[model samples]
Target: MVRNPLRAFFMMLGIAIGIASLTAMSTIGESTRQETMRQFKNMVGNYDLINIEPGASATRGMPSLTTVEPTLKFGDSDAIVEQVSGVKQVADVQNAFDLNVKYRDRTTAAAVYGITANWLEMHSYFIDFGSVLTDEDVASVARVAVIGPDIQNDLFEREDPIGKQIRIGGVPFLVKGVLVTRGAGPGGSSLDGIVFIPVTTASKRLFNRDYLTTITVELIEPLNPEPVLQEITAVLRERHGIIPPGEDDFGFVNPRAAAEQVAEVDSALTRILTGISVIATIIGGTVIMSLMLIAVSERRREIGVRRAMGATREDIMHQFLIEAAAASLVGGVVGTLLGVGGGVIAVLQQSMPPLIVWKSIGLAVVLSIIVGLIFGLQPAWKAANTDPIEALRS
Candidate 1:
């Protein structure tokens, strides 16, 4: 192997390309799955949390915040809390998009949400500083606001936002708290560019409507949302006076169902890519076999001389096999390192979390060695069977 530098490199190069592709694909697949779940959790909460939006079209996706729907009401939220058995907490929500938010001379557009006090907790949000909204704020219709990190930066900059008054749609509001940064949402929208106010204040003082945009429900027994879902559907249908065959006025977003959909898509893509990598590895093995056969032909004289010198057939075969395995092993190690670096860069480009699957790397190295032994068998046999008398005469 040391004497034939060019031949050894070609053998190593083929295996390296295949192993690199396999390892990198495995890393990317795992990272994508994890990142998708995390992003979903941030936007949709857990399986235990269900969001009910106005209009049947919401079943496909979240309803537009700008779409004016009068079908869902605040009473529906109260009824769910009182009537639904497995219900833990219910928060009524109303939202307005692209509202002009101003603090002194600074201004920016943001999504303003009118929410119950428990909205933050239900959505897994925490206050970075100051305080969250209280029941009193909603009841008394207090003109107070909680700002997101992006909102704080765009309007306040170096100034402290807490206790400072900011204007939303030209109405003055006291900044009660700032939320911990949530970064970008699942749909690539900015989650941090938002403002929260009491639902009552938004209805009476700002939008002046008697409706809600959505009702988010947290369940006690999350593993089975069917019973709770049925009950909620029944309550809403009966309250809205919808009979059989009538399309319901509300839609449900089940976090678990959404998660399953995402997993299916990711799984399909991963399988296709993995199959391609396997084919490449097989091609690499084929290349190794072809090259080794050529090497055996070129070195026929060496094999003949060794046989004349009383070197056993088994010894000649073993020597060739070991050379093949050594080349593959070195290539595997190099490929694994390169694959990990490539995977990290790919995930980072997609703004995904970096994750390494050590199990896959170990398996890839083992497989490379196995491929070397299997492909080298034919060449080893031919070298071992070379005749000595004819070669000496030549």
Candidate 2:
């Protein structure tokens, strides 16, 4: 290796490339998985929460302002709470999109939501100022509203939003509170660009419809949501007069199921990338074997001289094997440095949360050494089997 620097460098380069790819891809994969979960949590609250909507195609992960059909009613929400066991809280939701929301001279089109008093708590939203809606407000159909941070910024700007009146589709509503900033949801939708009103007020005053867009349910802690979900389905099916094998008008948006789906997709992608890296490592091993064979053929006379000078077959084999392992070990160290640098740059460029995987780095170094030993076997055998008398004559 010292006499032929170029050959040694080429042998190390292949192994380095393979190890670098494996380490870098594994680091990126873990970061992506965590990011996916964060996005899901932002869109839907927790694993024990489920949203039931009035259409068969409403198995969405995020809340929507529009519905395909209007079959869900306020009574459905009441029935779920009364009949379904392990249910902690339930809220009926009504939504209207692209409504003109105005605060004095400023105006913008935004989604308006009408929710029960427990809705904010169910969705894990905290009020930055003032207070949430009361049951009395919903029962009496009061003309009051809660605005999000985006709405506050768009309409009120520097002025105070509380106590000011905003008009939603030509109806005046007094602002009661402002929600804390939630940033963005799935698909970059603004979670704070909306208004919240009492469900009764929305049904009787704003939209004038008895149908609800969704029924949000929160299950009790330490309880399995599957049983509660089945019970809720059975109750809805009976109420809607649907028999077995008959198509139901309602669908569930289960947060747990959605989260599992995201996890599965991430896992599959990681497996495929890892497989590709393994293939590259194998190809690198093949290159090492081919080059070592050529070296053995060129240095047959050296083997004969060593043998005549009292070197045994085992000694000859060990020398070649050690040389191969040394090259791979050096390559592994270099690859690890390059891989870590690449991963850090990727996180900085994408502005993603940083996550370091030390286990993967350790595994990559081990894999390189194993590849070196396995591929060096054939060449080592050829060098060890050389005949001293025949080689000296040649």
Candidate 3:
């Protein structure tokens, strides 16, 4: 019986497939979790600026002042920062609408932002070359531009881009800086494809619009965000002469809260995927059990001969159990190797992080052994109970 490599090979194959399936699922799930964390970190770092929108209840009291607009202005940002306590810095940004930027003969749809000097500090932006916009540049309305890495590579190539002029909406602005590669954000939006310019320059040269698209604010140290949010909301309400809270037109977001929400979503996804993988493992265990029972029936004569030759019931049980365990062990090893390889491939191709979880591997190995013991018990017991005289006669 021990010399039958062919039988053992087929048994091991089934267990191996089951283990591999489970391992692959776990690896992918872990990779997803890592990717989610990376994206959440990029979206909102340690803190967030709040955007306040009017609630529905406020609309009933004052129809004129309670009507909420869809947008907020740069002027509103300034008022909130100045009047609200616990507010440190304000970076008011305005977006250009459908602006066609031309670089000689090359042109593309570009997202242009008009940002304050503190935008670099607030966002922790590092320039690859030249310099970011200065306070003087903003005050003087300097027509300078900071291009993203994609724009630099596409339009500039190896040529020196600093001091080169690019036309946006037919207005020529000199290239002042090139931004370092920041890759893509969690929203799958390109972070390295836009252009940044001083808010004052954008206001004077382009849209001439007084309204701001968004404002990101930094809070003072040791201040709880909830109270700070309330203070900012009150200031904005007072400044806008908002008689009704429901009609307020602004919106606020806390980056910390957003990160927490993302974490919760990722946790739920991990649990769901993990549960499915576990079910696959269980199915594999069932297959192993069924196969073992068939093998016991076929090998009854061999078991009877062994018993007739002085093998005890305990010996027969141990032998059969060992064969089942050997199959599971082989499967566990092969599955772990395949899982690790698949994880590496996923990380390389999908921009997801490598998740090498030792605990998951350990759990998989332990589960495989447990599955062997549990599934093999009935077959091993049947082999042990074989009557030497009856099995021999059959």
Query: Residue-wise lDDT of candidate 1 within 1-394, one digit each (tens)?
Result: 6778898888888888888998899899989988887777777655668888876543533344454357998999999999989999999999899999999999999999999999888888899998999999999999999999999999999999999999999999999999999876566677899999999999999989899988999999977887888899999999999887888888887777788788778878987887888777768877888889988888888888888888999999998898778888788888888888899899899888888999989998998899889988888888888776765554
Candidate achieving the largest lDDT: 1
**Which regions in candidate 3 have their CA more than 4 angstroms from the true location?**
1-3, 39-68, 187-189, 221-224, 244-247, 260-267, 301-316, 351-353
Error of 3 at 72 (Å): 1.9
lDDT of 3 by residue, 151-255 (tens): 887787888889999988888999999988777678666667788888988877886877676677787852367677678767777766777634655556656
TM per candidate: 0.89, 0.91, 0.84
Please rank every candidate by lDDT, starting with the best.
1, 2, 3
**Could you give me the TM-score of model 2 versus the true structure?**
0.91
Please give the range of 10 consecutive residues that has the lowest summed lDDT in model 2.
58-67
Which window of ten consecutive residues has the lowest lDDT sum in model 3?
56-65
Native-referenced Cα lDDT, model 2: 0.84
TM-score head-to-head 1 vs 2, winner? 2
> Each model's C-alpha lDDT?
0.86, 0.84, 0.73
